[model samples]
Target: MSKFRKKGKKSQPAVNTAALPDIVFMLLFFFMVTTVMRETSLKVVNKIPSATEVAKLEKKSLVSYIYIGKPIAALEDAFGSAPRIQLNDAFASKEDILLFVENEKLDRSEQERNKITWSLKVDKNTKMGIVTDVKQELRKADALKLNYSSKATDNIAN
Candidate 1:
């Protein structure tokens, strides 16, 4: 027999996968820390009206949402069926907007205050009168930058 005769079929070395679990855990933790979830839970039902021309907000930090809709079933027993304005998580009247805007501005850096845009997420079925009142209040508050949040429409006529 030759000196290099078959050494009983030499077995292949296995790959060391001890670091795989650590790598997977690191990736999971990275996504968990980096992802941003919605901060506010909406109390009102919002069926946004569709629009042909819809622009996405660039800086979400510079935008504050004003939800205008009829109160949910639970809140209806307390607030009635009238369209209400939701500032943050609470129901607010037109008069509350001034103070709300001022307070919101105070929370931001002075340089960013001017760039703040108020996004109105008004329900499709809500009355124009309520919307007009909200607009008037925004004007008085000098929070002139306004954005009407609406769903995107493929139809040009919409």
Candidate 2:
């Protein structure tokens, strides 16, 4: 036999997966850190109207949402079918907006406070009266930078 001949039938070595678990855990932690979960459970009937001119918000981090609509079926018995304003997770009166605005402002840095945009998510059939009230509250809060939340539509006239 030649000196350099292969030994019998040497079995191929198995893959060294020593770092596999570390890589898997690293990716898991990365996803856990980067993934954004829903923050609030909506309690209103939020059927936002559509508009042809709807523009996608560029910086969602600087936007705060104000939900306006009648209570959902689950809450109608308690809150009635009248239009209600939802700030975060709870129902709020028009007067509460000022405090809410202040709180939102406080959450951001001084430079970003003025840049924050308040987005009004109003239902299609919702009367203008409540919307007017919300606007008045925002005005009192000096939250003048407002945006109406609406989805993209091909035509509004239809």
Q: Name the best candidate (by TM-score).
A: 1
Worst 10 contiguous positions by lDDT, candidate 2: 2-11
lDDT of 1 by residue, 24-80 (tens): 999999999989898777878799988888998999899999999999888899889
Each model's total of backbone clashes: 0, 0
* TM values, all candidates: 0.83, 0.81
lDDT assessment of candidate 1: 0.91
Where does candidate 1 stray beyond 4 Å? 1-17, 156-158
lDDT computed for candidate 2: 0.92
**lDDT (CA) per prediction:** 0.91, 0.92
True-vs-predicted CA distance for residue 158, candidate 1, Å: 6.9
On a 0 to 1 TM-score scale, where does candidate 1 land against the true structure? 0.83
Candidate that scores best on lDDT: 2
